[model samples]
Target: MAKQVAKTNAVRLIEQQKIPYELLSYQVEEGQPVDGISASEKIGYSYEYVYKTLVTTVGKSQYYVFVVPVAKELDLKKAAKVVGQKKIEMIAVKELLGVTGYVRGGCSPIGMKKLFPTYIDESAETLDFMIFSAGKVGMSLKLAPHDLVKACKGNFADIVS
Candidate 1:
């Protein structure tokens, strides 16, 4: 059974893997200011290089993880095909927090509630490194895409829409 992890899953993930990682913390405002585009700017990084964690459902399945770029949305059809499913839809924002044990904007791919199938957009590999949430709001982790795949046990493909 999957463990009901604490609030610091991401950090624990790094420790578990014995891999070095740097947590990038930023001040998040009270309200929704900007989406991925502005988040990249706020963090002084490129939009494409920063990845977002999405919880998507295939048919009646609860959810699986999808890591996509901030500049592009998940192409549901492509994502489904890649994951060997007929259809997939993004889960509601509220549901994301529940399943991943992190808020919508702060869902980290590593140390999730369960080891659901994970897909990383192919574009993310083009860069040397990418940034993702640290299992907490306002914290991000910087690491190599290849290392991330090994660390998170994730697969890479062209699943972006």
Candidate 2:
């Protein structure tokens, strides 16, 4: 039997925007890695097509969202420079839900409690579409990169190494 996953805020927002997407779900057991890279392998998508949503804060109040390929590491200096901040660091895990309205492994660039400035890696611009978490650990979404950027009001930048 297959367990039905409930729709997440991310999914609802995508639908409301009339964006096209494919929902892919995988089994998640206790203590398994649900990070984007593992998700790519688990869901049988190439690592390049799997992107991750990361949240970082500038000072105490300003937050920025970054979407990068799962296999790449965010360049902190470039990230800070692109966002026009002195420095930025990843928000603590405890702050993920409070700030983004999503858990660590389920954070998506869309449908957050508030809209923060968002940046997608330049690499994604070359791809027609990409996959990201659906604001839930066991679910993922595949959608056009341009549609995602338009839906989230994000721009492409060289934020990852």
Candidate 3:
């Protein structure tokens, strides 16, 4: 039998929206670097299905969120264009907890302190489902990209480079 993981803010929000999702858990080996590719392998998901949530800021005061495959980088220019901002920069690691209420490796687009404008890579729009962090390290959620977009009030854009 498998142990049940506690619900996270992301899961709670999904439940509130009455959207379905599958939860996956994996071990985080001590002292080893954990990244999207390793997370996909650990969670038994394809690279294309595994997405990572990134929090970025526009200029000084505005913030935005983006989701992209772990293997790809966010195209800053496209991101700025899609979000209608002059410039966007990844939020510093030190500010993750305070800004988004999540750590770097466990950030989720859902249940953010504020619903910052979010964009998912257009590549995921064609897929049936995508996987992303469940607002916690060592855990992931699998759900339809449409459902996620609705739940997060986000849209799809060509934000990946």
Candidate 4:
């Protein structure tokens, strides 16, 4: 029998909106690092097509979500400019769960506790499909880039270095 995969909030939201996606899963050893790059490799996907969801803050309350390829790094200045903020910084690891209701390796831009303004790197704009965390450490979601943007109410921007 095939193992049944549990649905996460990100998966549920995608389904509720009738967005088509493929769920990918891999083994995650206890205490092993589950970074985006490792996730892409484990899932047999290219780093260019796998994105990492990052949460940043403008002040104490305003939050933003950025989705960029696992192979790239977010350009803080450009990200701030895209969001129209003078300055923005990544939320600390300790604050991630409380702020977005997601742990580090499981953060997905799709279904945060609140729908913050989200931006996807322009690099992904031309891809037929991309992958991101399924709100869990060992699972991922694969879907069209445009579909992801539409589902998250996000815009495409050059927010990577």
Judged by whole-model lDDT over C-alpha atoms, candidate 1 comes out at 0.81
Q: On residues 1-161, what C-alpha lDDT tens digit does candidate 1 reach at each position?
A: 96443447888878788887777767788876446667677788877778888889865555778899888888999988887888888888767766778887788899888888888999988788899888777778888898789877889999876
lDDT of each: 0.81, 0.92, 0.92, 0.93
* Candidate 1: stretches off by over 4 Å: 1-7
In angstroms, the error of model 3 at 78 is 0.7
TM-score of 2: 0.95
C-alpha lDDT (0 to 100) for residue 105 of candidate 1: 77
Best by TM-score: 4
Locate the minimum summed-lDDT window of 10 residues in model 2.
30-39
Per lDDT, the best of the predicted structures is 4
Worst 10 residues of 3 by lDDT: 25-34
How displaced is residue 20 in candidate 3, in Å? 0.9
15-43 in candidate 4: lDDT tens per residue? 99999999999999999888888888899
Cα lDDT tens digits, model 2, 29-51, are 98776777788888999999999
